[model samples]
Target chain A: MTPAVTGVAVTGVAVALPGAADARALLHPARPGAGPVDPAALIGRKGLRFKDRATQLGLHLAYAALSDAGLLQNGELTVRKDRLGAVVSSNLGNVDTVCRAVETISKESTSALSPMDTPNASSNIIASETAIRYGLRGPNLTVCNGRASGLDAIRWAALMLRTGRADHILVTGVEPDNEVTRRLVDGPMADGGAAVVLSRPAGTRARALLGPVLRTAQPADTAHQLVRQVPGGGLWLSAEDHPVPRSALRNALNSWGELSGALGVVQCAAAAGWFAEGNKSPAYALAGAAGAVLLAPEGTP
Target chain B: MTYPILGTGAVASIGADADAIFDSLCAGRSGLAPLRAFDPSRFNAQQLFEIDDRQTEGIDEPGRATRFLVEAIRQAAEDAGLPEDLAGIPVLVGTGLRELRTLELWWRDGVPLDADGLHFEDALRRHFGAVDTHTFAGACSASLYALALAWDLLELGEAETVVVAGCDVVTESMFGQADRVQFDPPPSVRPFDENRQGTILGEGAAAIVLSRSAPAGRPVRGRLHSVAVNCDAHHQTAPDAAGVEDAVRQAQAQAEVTPADIDLVVLHGTGTPLNDRTEAAVTARVFDSPGPALTGIKSLTGHTSGSAGLLSLIVALRSLERGLVPPIAGLADPLPEAAELRLVAGGPLAAPLRLAQVNSFGFGGVNAVAIVGGAA
Candidate 1:
């Protein structure tokens, strides 16, 4: 049996989806044909030129999440640099940059490649950039583990807190809808970012307590297993096309479109919002290959 | 909460299996050769550590990286005497450029792109019947990150057994980028050498099977004592000595061992000027004068990128089993800063190895260090 992850609480939540003002908007169905995200409007114009779309989206959400957690004030961190950690998940975060660079190299000479853009080719740029911008000197990790990346990032952050590696961890999942990503996947994609601030439940108001993530190879099995853990009258959120019968189950993918790497975090943000609205039942979020996480409202043992 | 290393596997330019690679290392064979996977005339540096085409002939359809990874996992499972149907065992793969070569080929040759092959989960599911798979892309330190997470899973009782693997293949995009960045790139990689030019990309994969409990009737390869990961939050391309030092200190602290107790140190010597210097400085600050015997395999294997971490760990474990530390393949004149440290060179050094430390630092200031104890 996997040990229960106790004392880790979600203190803050933020999302940068198109047509969504706050996390609560995610609880409702997403607006039809939402316009593309404008990260410049949310964050700023400066430092937006060199960053890729995924990084831009991630930065905006991280800033908002940090502020919501009361850890950031006026663009400055309120906690020690070493006590803060950052983990970002995106399966196709840097695909556009990488594909563009590859195209340039194939068509033009190596000399045509800009040195400034070389760093963006690295997959961990988003996570590292977030840490550098926020002065998060603690353990930084980037998860690109396919569909499970977002939830895996959350699980990794929880382990970091459980092992006393960091007092607080900023977890963000972002995916960009661009020429390359569109070519890779079919159908409209949920191209945005979502972030949650997970920290040890000490001296902080907890919005919800995170339970251990249960994983299985098959999506149907994972959904069934996840549903078995929570009590009755809980709201279940899943992106998989599993046929699990539940009284109050919602497929975020149907409502928000295909979120890819951002689905898990978006589902998590929605659950946190659900709790913030004074709901008492435990909320569950499950992504097909990513497994499931149970979010219990505050004061749950 | 130490996890026992039950089995090991590897596929590199030097050899196909873990034991063969270790033997090649002990014999001081360098895998550096002219790049044959792609046209090398376009790049300033023409040399790389590329695996033989014959080895991946049958399984090179989707990508050579996947081929190497699948081969490595098969070897690891076979070595651990695991069932043919892996059923519920979870797989965690670390990679820098997952299927980028395949994507590049598709773009260049107009081949039909199969999105399923872009990630390792499908391949794992087909090959080993692995249902749960996690692919980490943390650059060069990716596999170590996966290994660290594997350890966490075992420690938390998430799974009794876990498969950790890392793989990457040389892509034209990376080659072109390196050609532009490296100043007068040399044909060979020479770590710790004063004239070390830059890293030569390598293609390969390595895997290790770790278990919470020792496998019944099977000899344990080693015990993973601790793994410490951190970020400099300093630079994207440049490594920070402070971050590297912190990781080394934290690993030693978690393992409850002093520098003197470690018999060997597998340096993440990328052969890049800044990286080697930063690593040497960190080594000097952490250990006493002429610290534990240090060896950099990149001089022979070229920087394997994502798989480099596990390859180094495998070398350390092999050193523990064979009592022979492989020498740095192409080191003649050590950097003046690294002179105080014991940089093994010329030939393999015989020693009664017990504890070994492996360092793997990557782009974006990502750093991971692992300390492993040999089963004597």
Candidate 2:
């Protein structure tokens, strides 16, 4: 079945990757950092000392996305609280907390476990933490779809806008570089995230228009199908590290090495930035095994 | 734009199928028993209502949660009379904490970390042939969110059919956490009772196949009217009456129903002092007088975490079909402070039930409410 096509707009975009502190840096990266950057300064030093690393990444990206959308000025939200929804996507959500909780429960008495740190073990707490910190009172949803979480979240947020569920939805994809996730992957995974503000098509910062999000069975063929479907000499942005000799292919996963949940949105945001800078080509992002979304410059059709 | 629920499937402690579970519930059969899945002798509250894994003896899945989910989904799919081609259908599963025992085994045995938390979705995709799969983990209300997502997909015409499932198995890690926090009850789950101590955690799984319209000749179990989810932003562990009340009001508004229209309420009564009291207050606020029949199935199933919400949905559907709302299993005396709302006790209450509301509250102040209508 074809999804209900609505006039959804990409009002703002942001990223929290290594070396690049904000959305602008991700687009214009003079030197990509070799590893994850400590986001303590961006999140401030007062109250977030005990927060999990994933939550810190989520907060930084949420604020940056809202700020880029002009919804936040001086750290205060410009729009009404109830009209803004928050959806956080993650593959390995707060794995550090889970490992810690399990280890604590195994070794020490259950009573001795740190009550403050135990709440962070849950997957939904990341979104809840971001919402509580920023006072976002709209529908808060936490989606986990492995690598495809970011792109799926983008699609879901667009539907939320189309159905008038929220005036503007802040969608984020985040994962932390921790021991648990690292061990699970048998290597170091990048710790970062990407966020975008989805709104009605009539916004001041409408940089790109979202197309249909298609979910195919095979991840191997997703990139090719997505690239072949979009015809008009546009760019194809993807999280795939290597490509098959495609001229319009631009690999964002190389610079931002392997952000599991954050890969798809990062590609989409970077592609939007390229389009904002006079590149009229449509950008297609293939989120591994999940699906793909084709983003075109405003008024492309 | 009404989506008909084609069928419901469950693998709980009481029974393995929806019909048996419904029969057990209506007959006032309690599934509560001492923990058998694991030796809970050393724990604070050494009692739980665990699903009998022997029934699923031939399943090769390593994780208990995965096994239960696969069986439940198969039953639901068969009941829905699904077509041979299963393409273009999205699968949404909700879980809490995952299978802790298996993870611990893998962690301590130095096994390759390939069995990540998202492995369950991969397994479902491979075994069930569902290309579009997603998982939700919002504590006790996770599966409700899964069902809500399926509803949205159907309402938006994103998919013709969607399978929403939820499963979770109690493990030593969970029991240890609860014991450490002193949240375990000594006897049993006595919901809304004056002498309630706490809750006995349990494990189970359930699935519902939702379609835009009912099948050609199959029976429609119920119709999902509306669902609303919200967060309190209050304390992480504490119960918030205001948030629960807000969620109910929003659900009622969306469903276009008032307290007078509600014939029954399936509460998320965890049997804890705070949760029961907060749930009672929210029910009283919604209805000025003694509201519709209020009951909780946690007394029989224990708290199944992720699967609790869908299990409660199954119980509500059963109640609507049988016109009998089951009483609180161990609730001997209702707390006078929470007596403003009618609590089904002693035995099943027979009434012409039409509309029922299901409430599910999880950690981190997450509250979800959904309205379901009986068969037309």
* Native A-B contact fraction in model 1: 0.54
TM for candidate 2 is 0.92
Which candidate ranks first by TM-score, i.e. highest? 1
lDDT of 1 by residue, A172-237 (tens): 999888877777766666678699998886445666778756677667776666656655536777
> Per-residue lDDT tens digits of candidate 2, residues B1-376?
4578887889888888878877776666767776664434445566777776644432212377878888888888887887533456887888876655456545644433462455366667666777787777777898997887787788787788999999887755566667666763558788999998888778789999989988676798899988887777676678778878888898888889888999999999998988998888878878878679998988888899988999899889989988988888888888875777789988889999999999998887777898999988
Q: Candidate 2 at residue A36, lDDT?
A: 68
Q: Give the alpha carbon lDDT tens digit for every residue of A76-173 in model 2.
A: 98987767788888867666665565566556545666656666756787788777777776667787777777888887777677766678888888
Q: Residue A52: error of model 2 in Å?
A: 1.7
Clashes of each: 1, 2
The per-prediction CA RMSD against the true structure, in angstroms, equals: 2.4, 3.2
After superposition, candidate 1 runs with Cα above 4 Å error: A1-5, A32-34, A251-257, A299-301, B54-61
TM-score of each: 0.95, 0.92
Which candidate tops lDDT?
Answer: 1
Q: Each candidate's chain B TM-score?
A: 0.96, 0.93
